[model samples]
Target: MPGSTDERRAAGYRPLLFSIAYGMTGSVGDAEDLVQDAFLGLTRARQEGTEIVDPKAYLTTAVTRLGINYLRSARVRRETYVGNWLPEPVVLPTDRPGPAEHAELADSLSMAFLVLLEALSPVERAVFMLREVFGYGYAEVARATGKTEANCRQIFARARQRVAAGGQMIAFRSSPPERRAEGEQLARRFFAAAAGGDMNALLGMLAPNVALHVDTGGKAQAFGKPLAGRLPVVRLLLGVFRRAGILGVCLRPAWVNGRPGAVKFDADGSVTGVIELDITDGMVQAIHSVANPDKLAHIRLNPNEA
Candidate 1:
């Protein structure tokens, strides 16, 4: 439960609200902005002498609706996006694991899950996230979205189907410590192969039909379209790393979106890019690369880490 004062309550609930907003919008910047806006709305409402019987419910509704509206307006920009769009990666520290405040929803934070969410409509996404990811009951979901319980149920069903069709829904459960450790180990080998230019090892680790999706926002260097098939992806990766090596770039393994991934750093310790691996059954299914400086702006790294 949150504190009695509006400001204290907002502070206490920020993590929960941030998880919801990030899940809904798939953009860290947008999520933070939406949370701020929601709190501002709460303050204004209180100033107007409005009674807030349940601060949690009121804030949840405010953030969810703001996310819905934000997504509705962002669709146009997304449609016109120059290259494959990827959710801004949520990079976490690998050495010091933090408290699991919203760990139950971690799977939904993955790049794969967030990408599938793009297939859904604004309200549909809201209803589905509230019910599925957060475990909110139909009644609670309806209250948040201003819809009837029946409507919320129907929306959730439809959204679930759509997401499933787009791709498999990541289980809502948090990854066990051993599972996460295994993923980090695999990621280390994958990046080592790439950096060392060991094509054979890389090929062995990659799924046969693995695809490479890069988001450069047409503002940086990247393949204009996604590259499919193992050989091509491996070739491209080797070539990129070969070039990167010459430029004195290094890889620092980290937990990306709650999965194993790495951050790329330049000679001066600046973040140049991020790589998130979608591993399934001991094979890399997809390689998601984010090089657009705008997207990497939020990523912080210690240069000596690598």
Candidate 2:
């Protein structure tokens, strides 16, 4: 294995595989599974000595095919998904030097953008992502998804129109004076109070229309569905924090879906929960909480543990 070129090629599959799989399956868990399968496919192809001259191109096509196939059936499967199905939230690594490249990756991974993609038909989504996110030409996208050049062009145009027509607008914008500050202050106050087990203070921060959505994928313990209204949200969070205990959880500012976000840290300062807030008019509109154990693998602390 010292100088094997095959090993190097295999190592390179993850970046493309992750992109394709994530574009296909909005769920990070599903995207990860698909990436594993893509690697396995590459491995088996190598075992048979298929002589992949352009490894990157081959992996791209293979992964795209797999993703497109999955998308063709994903709608049927997702119909049965519990609660309002949403894309998994991720903490994007932004240390990359090239601003354009980093921004593209970060933009593609946003929960807001992914949610917008949900409205697109599976084939349309594939064409749009392959063309837009990966910088593939219409003909190249066509080959990857088994569509004609004309069809790919049409789909891309339609997707562009949809985006321009506001079906897929960026969920948030550059924070202006009318937004961000007051909203963040309120969220910080609420999170601080909740972490301290102060129900009264927590309730005071929530708006009358506050809604909370917790996603644990049923594999982790969390609110089963989105809880709506201030009373319901406040009550639910109260029960949650009361049981979770005061572990000195602190909320730190973060960007989620290009919007204001916060991370909850345990007593030892390990992130445990990542919350995406939908703020309107400086009031908390909606809350999407990601506490799935699998999703929180990067999280180093437990809310139940100090």
Candidate 3:
């Protein structure tokens, strides 16, 4: 029902809406579907002759509520999931420029941050993301979430405490330019060490308490539980890469969820897996690997010479 002007405006807001939805629900497909549903709701409202003073706010609210509902349903499924649950990886080109604002956005999109968010309840996650990540005021968050301003504040406070208790804070602070450069350099060394079977070099780059989490969803082979400690993780990774090498699998350096990572491709050029490294203090703190075919459906890569 929207005219050309209104349609164009709504289209322009798709990126922001997608970000919010994706932050709320760490699944790219769900986020995109929620955004489409929000726009469809807007169309219905306009067709009903309802005047919208601010389409952005309206659509945001719709998407948030929809995401909350979706999470309420998804939480149950996640409980009985086959193996370690992980968000679908968002891969980007390594050469992409990351300014300050972009870095902050990247932090929120990281696999570690999204995994941390799983601790909060649906409304708590929504309130926290609106206030802490997106910088929405209490009143704005209240209107978007259908809660009073005071209640929204309380929810955000509780969410913050929960996140902090998890040993991480959900702040939008960007890493220093030098620190980012160090992470990139470390990631390169990490992949090189693994490929070359340099066990000592790989051990040197990993944190003392480094943890590895692989999500295969019972589709591909992976550990039943999160593997902890430096030596075991290193051993597992080396074995996996060694086997992959025998099968003509290729590893391509990429940016996964804003962190230095890589994508694995099969001999036929199909995506086999994605790996994201959480680097801190110049060491790899966490290794997140996703091999579930369902989650890898969105990742497309051109065939490279094997």
TM-score of each: 0.93, 0.65, 0.93
Model 2 lDDT per residue over 1-306, tens place: 113666775665575667567767766567767767766776677778777666666667777777777877888877776555566655432222222212334334556567677777777888888887777887788877788999889989998777666543654324564464665566667666766767777666667877687766666666566688877787777777776565555666655544456666667766667777766665767788876555666433333321
**What TM-score would candidate 3 get against the native?**
0.93
Q: What global local distance difference test value does model 2 have?
A: 0.65
Q: Please report how far candidate 1 places residue 26 from its true position, in Å.
A: 1.4
lDDT by residue (82-133, candidate 1, tens digit) is 9899999888767764334334234557887888899999999999888888
Pairs in steric clash, model 3: none
lDDT of candidate 2 at residue 120, scale 0 to 100: 79
Task: List candidate 3 stretches off by more than 4 Å.
Answer: 96-107, 170-173, 303-306
Clashes of each: 0, 0, 0
Per-candidate Cα lDDT values, in order, are 0.85, 0.65, 0.84
Global lDDT of model 1: 0.85
